[model samples]
Target: MSRSATFDRQMLETAFSEIDAVHRSLPEATLSTLAAEVVTRVANNLRFAVQPDMVPCLDEIDMLCNALLSDDPHAATAFIENVQTKGSSYETLCLLYLTVAARRLGEWWDNDDVSFYRVTVAAGRIYAILRILRMERPIGVPDMQRAAAFASVPGENHTLGITIASDLARERGWDIDLFVGLTHDALVETLEQRQPALIGLSASGRRSMPALTRLIVALRISNPNARILVCGQIAAANLALVGLTGADAAAHDFQGAIGHMERLLDLPTGRLI
Candidate 1:
């Protein structure tokens, strides 16, 4: 395995082990406090390797969540703006509290209704970390003819999925352009201008499907030759719907999507419009 992959796996394993250990030895309240501290420490460590601007904001999120656990409504409300400014990741942070609540309340993990607010929060933090890496640009294209652009649907907040997909594309030397949130008009304009060989859209929720479909239709009408692909939670959950919505294909996972795109583009019939 690559050094980065090995390191990531080791870190995740350590984090999970630490979480389990903390749950065993600490009181429910104490475990909640420790989780906040762990998030703060992890965020700080990540910032040391990346941007310092993220440290303060991430720390504040930890503080706000700590306050919420204690039922400090005032403190919770105070951090609302900070949370919103940070985007959907903040929602994931809020979800992290659910894990603590579950452990403290003696809730069963297998219960489908058992909330995973904490898991979501952790996922958000992961998203934030990945975003700092700017994982979308293709790394080593040999020539302009081999270049490709990548982007996501506008108003689409599920950037981590695209970021992962982009990282893989970059490693394979395909040029990528990652657009986080663009309206239908902006995306259409972009498609007309760049005329990329492949365009990938990331959607996290069903709410974004209508706009996604419209965007795909617009792209098909305006740039019928461009390859269109969709991936992420929404697409995976509704693959049939997504495929039917005019996307040439949908990838259920990041690596799968990348492989699909490469294979599709390699075909003789896959000429760019």
Candidate 2:
């Protein structure tokens, strides 16, 4: 039998409470209808739940997504507040929203229900929220002297996946360096100079495969012992393809990436609770 994950009841309650605020003004019939729609959407698509017990229900996730995507001036703030109250850590929250929440909006856009303008607006709001949250906290000091570097494969415009992983690594007291928009040559030069203990590379699609393979080859030549992990939309789906790039491993998500980092470095993993 599968073991039950340890889940904090208080965290689930807190999430529900925040969601309750949004439902307070709706009539019973309206609330029921909305809840049904939320469940349907979640069921029809892929949803990432952090823990079986603590996972936000369909209604709660739907509420949060609506708040972020809606035109209301206060909606984004409310969504952030809900996440802040329910999420265990900054990194975890970022991963959850980056994947689940963002994907939900993208699905709507694909159906022509959500416009490009609204999607960009919601993304900006999330970026601002993350900026404020990270800035409010004191800079982290590395627990171990080892350092890690993160960057996207050349030609991939989206680097947020690695950025989120970097933030989590920084929080865990790992020396983290993030580079964006770097060509393969530039990345190789930087990696050679840093010779970090670990390196993470992100690639968004199959088009990045060739450049990624070249970058990985250069990375191995520069720092033969550095633990390399490939991550991103394509990495999560096609892990075997990542191995063809000569990396040590490919992360399925931010949380899985952290676990791999701990294992590769011989460091103890942190408990989510």
Candidate 3:
């Protein structure tokens, strides 16, 4: 059965008002990034807040991902529909299957297991599915005081980690803007325009530290209020590394990221409900 909306319309309107204020102030170089992030945070959580969904197996995820990369435009959509018809919930198809498939696609790109173009095409399908899923969900509130953006170091060849981390953050109720495949200047420029409250950066190895450090500095200079979290292989480094990068915290895994993110976004009243 279809459920009634579980949101306060007034609250959403108030949030949009704040977003509009930001939009009006900033030159709109990458308008879609900010808009999509807001929508995703609202759409992904509202239904999940009401009811949970099932998860798909690795094989199933691979099948759907393969379909997504097929030449037929309808293959991916058909696969999603078939899964739903088989009694998998819409929530399952989205958060479980489609989301995981994104990670898989990113994995291939990172390891050079597949061509970047192929991975990009597959990733686009996953995004399309997510957007379509949004249409079925009721308009909802973000329930956070500020939004976040996740990005890989400008030239980092390994980006799957940030993609996974961002999805995990969104799963845990963050409004997240993702910056991938951007040049150093472009990433910094787009970030300045978005002005996110928090920024998550991923670096696979020590080789990326210089670029990573530079990025944190640029972000700090440009977005003074934003908290930065350093993750991926570099997070395993000692306390000295954190100070060197000037990141507020470093986390090697999901739980640590969650804990640090919470502390960063904390209010006197505690984390927003």
Candidate 4:
């Protein structure tokens, strides 16, 4: 997970303005201190701005969370579509409701409130819903910052989640180059050829960590500007993953993956959402 991320447009603009001022006065000074402070403040603001709105959606999200783990697959889709029909934009549906539900399932798994099997099924349902939603928009040229690649660790075979993660990112206007099943060398070769701005890799267990770390190192050398995000099981130890593997960020769900991308690239706030 990126330690510094901000979603507020005004705050970013204000911070940049301050940096511009400093540049004018002390052109020779290094900006490490200023950058750190601004990043921390802006990151804190994301929590402040989003948490209150989350309360209003909690009841609906909670209900949807349960539906996700239910036996009938249609239950989760019907519930999400019903809420969407009640006036939630597709963007809001993905960014807020589905995101909250995903996190809730994660917490349940963490606390042993739900079994891995149930949570895995529920997460799969969410991915299916995202793929269905992708058809709502016309695909277009990917913005420089919106192009990315999705892959799985070299020896790991679990890719259904990351496939849907790519779809969710697409629904949010990303151009995803999926290399989920390719071997380590082939994946690196393709990434080096395409040079996507972001890369997302899924890892299922500690066994995948060594491979994931090595891939990140290769990316750092081969595609120096490519920021890597580790998702799935490895995301449980995000900070450690970043420190140990040289990954720029980690996310457990699609929304956070996109959030990290925007923050990592410092993209403008105006979005298709």
Which pairs of residues have clashing backbones in candidate 3?
none
Clashes of 2: 0
Regions of candidate 2 where Cα sits further than 4 Å from its true position? 1-146, 271-273
- lDDT tens string, model 4, 1-273? 112111233332333343234334422222322222222222222222344643436677678878877876556656765765556654456555666676666667669897655654564455444433432333343358677788888888888888888888888787788877788778877888897877888998777765775576456545645668888877875437764455778887767877887876667544566
Estimate TM-scores for all models. Answer: 0.43, 0.45, 0.45, 0.47
Candidate 2, 1-273: lDDT as tens digits: 121112233443333333444345434544433333332322233334466664556676677667766766466565555566653564455444434665666577668786655554454344334334433434333345546788888888887777877887777777788998987678878887877777888888777765675576456444545778887777766536532444677876887777777776666668433
Better of 1 and 3 by TM-score: 3
Query: What is the Å distance of residue 77 in model 3 from its true position?
Result: 63
Candidate 1 lDDT over residue span 1-273, tens digit each = 011211133333343343334345534444344334333323332211323432344345456445443322334333433444445332133223222232332222235332344533332233222221112212232234435566676777667778877777677666688777776667777777887767787777777665665566456434545667887777667546432454667876866676667655763222244
- Top model number, lDDT: 4
Candidate 3, residue 82: CA error in Å? Answer: 72
Which stretches of model 4 miss by more than 4 angstroms? 1-143, 269-273
Query: Candidate 3 lDDT, tens digit per residue, 66-179?
Result: 886776645665676677666665555554565567666656656878764455445434444443354345533334554678889978888887888777667656778888
Clashes of each: 9, 0, 0, 1
lDDT, candidates in the order shown: 0.49, 0.59, 0.60, 0.61
Residue 271, candidate 3: C-alpha displacement in angstroms? 10
Off by over 4 Å in 3: 1-146, 267-273
Q: After superposition, how far is residue 206 of candidate 1 from its true place, in Å?
A: 1.4
What lDDT would candidate 3 get against the real structure? 0.60
Clash-forming residue pairs, model 4: 1-250
> Model 1, residue 17: what's the lDDT?
41
